[model samples]
Target: MKLKVDYKKCEKAGECYYNHNALFERTDNGFPKILVEDLTTDALRHEAAEAIEVCPTGAITIEE
Candidate 1:
């Protein structure tokens, strides 16, 4: 699986950080930091999905 974050639509709520900091974080100005440029593990994919869920702007997408 693969994950993609749309920086344009990101609202920077940081819910992904609360759920899984390994995959996402907030920038100094308060935007989600795209941590894993390339994710090949199931664990990382799961966390990415979690990030997608909480994004207020629906900025994240997962591809299988």
Candidate 2:
């Protein structure tokens, strides 16, 4: 699975990083930075999904 982020739609809410710090990180400017681009495990996939759901702007998407 691949994770895609729509920067234009992002609000810099930091919810993604708060929910799943292992998969997402915060940049110096307070935007989200994907720590794991490719979801290779079940745990990672689930975590990514949670991050997507938690994102207020719906900026994150999963590509399978």
**Number of the top candidate by lDDT?**
2
Q: Write the per-residue lDDT of candidate 2 for residues 1-64, one digit (tens) a residue.
A: 8988899999999999887899888999988889999999999999988988899998999998
Off by over 4 Å in 1: none
Model 2: lowest-lDDT 10 consecutive positions: 16-25
How many clashes show up per model?
Answer: 0, 0
Pairs clashing within candidate 2: none
- Report how far off residue 15 is in candidate 1 (Å): 1.1
The digit string of per-residue lDDT tens for model 1 on 1-64 reads 6677787887777776667788777678887676775779877877777777787788888866
TM-score of each: 0.77, 0.93
- Per-candidate Cα RMSD to the true structure, in Å, reads 1.7, 0.8
Candidate 2 root-mean-square deviation in Å: 0.8
Q: Report RMSD for candidate 1.
A: 1.7
* Global lDDT of each candidate: 0.76, 0.90
